[model samples]
Target: MSLQFHNQLTHRVDTFTPQIEGKVSLYTCGPTVYNYLHVGNWTAYIYWDTLIRVLQANGLRVERVMNITDVGHLVSDADEGEDKLEKGARREGKTAWDIASFYTDDFIKGMARLHLLTPQHIIKATSYITEQLELVRTLQKKGFTYQIDDGIYFDTSKFPSYGHFAGLDLDAQKAGARVEFNPQKKNPVDFALWKFTPQGETRDMEWETPIDLLEPIVADGLEYEQANKKMGFPGWHLECSAMAMTLLGKTLDIHTGGIDHIPVHHTNEIAQSEAATGVTFAHYWLHNNHLKVNGTKISKSLGNGYTLNGLGEKGYSPLDFRLFVLQRHYRSEGNFTFENLESAKNRLHNWRNSAALRHQTHDRLRDDDEKSTDDESVSLYASSQALIEAISNDLDTPAACAIIDEAFRKIDGINLEDIHQHALTSFIETVDNLLGLALFDTSKDISDDIKRLIIERERAREKKDWQAADRLRDQIEKSGVTVRDTAHGSIWEYVA
Candidate 1:
């Protein structure tokens, strides 16, 4: 089956065909780098990672771009609150620059721990200020932007397709305006492209506005003029549009983000991007559903947010969390609990053990010159085909995982002598590439001390010295290694 994705733009599962043949331009919204990324934040990355793997598995060269929003993400979607980075800085008693640097590193480390592939281009919003300003200038010249007391705002009324992606009711929104109803705004739905710095207040991160871009405005029967040299920052939605277009191009094959961005953030991106360039912004739009905990949204305000280190403190590896995420489809809402996480942990452990046993059996039996019979080859081919079919169908990860479970059961039933080493190796590598699980890793070099201890423990076991064997086992475990006594011999692995 060919790969398909549920494009949020069309609200349909469409077959994916890149704009350029043999190459796919993909972009995913990265973290704001204001604080440590919680599990909820990680879920979006996992979904995008799976998408990238699926695309590459289909033999399409992918040029993926993810942005690190170091600045310009306001606390509220209305773009009326403090910058998230600046808020974080105030909360942590650090400079905004320090906060961004620290959190960006932390986010990258968490991604590495979860085995997420780094994108081809990871651009920071602060690094692309020139591009963002240029984009704002383009919108102003195109007569799609208006200036207010706060900053430059996009005139959503001018863009006929405003809120088309989200199905927003412009008249209804104006009637039932709940918050951030700026009276100076020509329309309540209009959003800021750049925000002016507050009077008599200095900001650590602000850029001087271009003198020639100011336009006159009339408010409350009085003529007002925009500050030509005002210091301000870009808006949250502006950064994504600028960075994505700067790196990927005017149009992208796929644009991905959390479902929460569907309403205002992504809608504004479409309005401004299409308004500036008289073409479609992206071919496909994909969003992952929210990750909840204890029946509530995982947020810092709710005190339900969790980080990777928090999981480790509770005795769960990052891959265990990854497994938990994959057990459910990305488009479905997943509720996380310790019980569910434990189940995923146990599943991962069993799968890893089975894979190790298969490797050991393959090493013990097949000779270098031996080849598999027709039956073995057929079994391997069937298992591989099942996995491919499962993953290719809209990234049905839960189905793919079930196929893995079935493959392991089949492996357990087959005799080691009948399995072909080359075929088994190829199958295992393909599975790893598709799943992003380090299942076939056996590259750890055991130290001489641990090896000698294992040997002594084996001798003690053979001599019926249970007490000495138990003591040696404890010592080996204290050295951060786990030992399992099998019928063939004892196997040791590092404690993750």
Candidate 2:
């Protein structure tokens, strides 16, 4: 089956055809690195990881680029307020550069813990100031930019398809007196491309632009005077367009982010990029729905936000959280709760145990007999194909997980002696590859103390001493090994 993605630009689930055959050029918006990433932020990365895995599963090479917004991203998406990094520095009592580095390291660690594939190119917004300035210059030269007292602004009226990607009704939005318009802005929807540093205020992240003066060109009743070598910073929307085109060519095969970005951030990107290049900014725009908690958006302001460390403190492995994310469809909103996470934890525990049992059974069979059959290979291939088909249809991870569940049921229902061990192993490994669950690495050697506790727990269970068994189980868990009692015996594994 051909892969399909629901492109936000076209508002349809279109078949994916790469700009270049057998390869994909993908870009995903990275975090602002102002603070610890909450689970809501991580959801976008999880879905993007699944997309990359699915693409690679279909034998396509993916060159993915993700950016770290260390500078220029403001507290308000509307191009007003302090830079987020500077705000974070004030809150934490550190330099803006230090804050960016520290939080970026934390973000990377979180992604690694979640088993997310790191992008091939991880660029920082601060590292590409030259490119950003050049992009602003290009827009200025094209007569698409105008100057105001605050900064260089992109004239939305000049871009005919300004709001096409977001399906924004520009006329109605302009007519409605919903938002306070900037007096210097010609159109209500005009956005900043460059922001001039406040007079007599020194900023840690501001830079001197090459442009000698902000031209005194007047357009739409807005006038400005030239200031030689004005110190300013790039706008939030300009960073992505500059960096993406610098690394991934003028057009990208896929550009993904949270659905929240569709309205402002991504809309501006499309406007500035297409206006400059006169071509499509990206071939496909993929967005994942937000992650919510308790029927509300997961946010720090709500006090419902959680970091990976916070989840770890609650005794949940990162992969358990990853499983929780995968059990739901990316396009659908997922309500996060500890109860749901516990359910996913148990499910993953059971799945890992089943895979471990299969591995043990396969080992025993291999020792006894080395014979294989062509029918077994055919069956394994068919099972793999079914799994791929499930994921390929717009990344239906829930359906793919259901297929794995069915496979496990089939393995359990059939006779162990009659089962082809190699095929079963191959099928399980392939599923793990696609899902990135790390189920096959279940042979983690338990410490001798944990082994002794497991023995005591087993004895307590044999004696029908429920209280003692429960106590030993608690002790085992405190030692960082999860204990699962099986019909055969008690099983233990490290807590990730």
Candidate 3:
């Protein structure tokens, strides 16, 4: 199967082949772990989930690593603000570590509800301080790092291709409206790899660098710092560069984040990573556009960001939001409206109810006599093959899902013969086996039992006897699998 997805770097859809055969490694920027993830941000998660599902559908082994920035992320992208965790601590009246841990747990719980497969590894910035410092040391040794009074900075000019990933020109980022130009910086685009704290402040998470160890820094907040005192942690951009390089290598098969992250955040990562390793940062850079409300981008400071909890307060499930996300291509910004959600929820409910009906019909066919298990198996095998074909094609889930509806309708109009009915049972079994979206209790042995019936139907169909196949197909549909007849054979699958 060939999968074609849009690559932001190339600005076009390209064929996807893994960097290595049968294996792909992906690194996505994870939440900053400072607050509940706003839904706009959660689109990145869902977009990646769909991609991962498609990868699995194509039979590739995927290894994914998403980082947790519990520490080292400053409130401002320019490295001019307080550490975000510390800022959150002040807001919540807790320790910095407490804030980080609290939000990290919250993010994990949200992923559980969203049905996202957990990343193979979840690394945290705080857990890898030594590794981060080592990266700083490497860059410094390689002449890619320059130091200001507060902390070390990565020289973006050291690598000329710094801002291209974000569709940004180098000079534009240096002078962009959102950027802050520091006088101490050698270049306007240089970003901190480390930061010095104002003198005398009690930093709950401060660490001593080689410079700090060498100087007897005075502890006075009003005195202000030209050197490290109580300043805590690395800058956000540098943390990603260091962590991503450490865990997934300097280059990755894919790098994913939101459109918001493109400019300063991901741009800096690309700059620092490539400068540090002198290699490409990522082969494919994918970014999902934002979700908007009434044509404005949804955000928290504007009092417009809604979480899954906030949406549910009005009696909507997170699944409703998930379905809403599915309605649009990931590249396009989707508008969120209560009216839109209502329509989607109605359609979702209709699909499930209709699919379930189709499956119930597949139940009756297993009782066929002379239902040689072989006939049942063949019928099922043929049906599932077709269903799998629909899903594996660029994750055309809507098409694959629609096929279920069509199959149910077709099976509803059929009567049973041994072979035809058996063939129908087999198709039902096939759809269930491949998609894992059937409405049955998968933990129960019902799937196995259904597969056995399908084999009998397949054998019946092979004999060129329509009566037994049709009978078994009807029986299987009665069992809750929808069956359809084709010129080639009979097929069946779960209704919902």
TM-scores, all models, native as reference: 0.88, 0.87, 0.75
What value of lDDT does candidate 1 attain over all alpha carbons? 0.84
Candidate 1 local lDDT, 1-496, one digit each (tens): 5888899899999998899888999989999999898889999898789889888888999999999999988888667789999999999999999999999999888889999999999889999999999999999999998888888999998999888899888889888876645888888889999999998888889988776667643466443444235788989899999999988889999999988999989999999899888899999999999999988988769888988999999999899999899999999999999999999988887677556544344534355434544456567667777877777788899998887787667665455556555566666777778888777773235678888999999999999999999999999999877787755467765564
Model 1 error, position 271 (Å): 0.7
Stretches > 4 Å off in candidate 2: 178-181, 216-227, 363-381, 413-415, 443-496
As for TM-score, the candidate ahead, 2 or 3, is: 2
Tens digits of per-residue lDDT, candidate 3, 1-496, equal 6777677778887778777888877888899888888778787788787777667767888788889988767766567677788899999999988998999999999887776778898888887777777777777878887766677788877777777776666666456645444778877667888776666677767676655222345656545354333344677787777777777777788888888788788888877777778888888877887899767877657787888898889777666677677666677778888888777666555444433333333334445454543454354455456566654554455565566556544444333333344455455454444433332322122366676777778888789677987787777777777555556444454444
Backbone clashes (count) for model 2:
0
lDDT of 2 at 5: 91
lDDT of each: 0.84, 0.84, 0.69
Provide the lDDT at 369 for model 2: 36
Candidate that beats the other on TM-score, 1 or 2, i.e. the better one: 1
- Which of 1 and 3 is ahead in TM-score? 1
User: Residue 129's C-alpha lDDT in candidate 3?
Assistant: 79
User: Per-residue error at 71 for model 2, in Å?
Assistant: 0.9
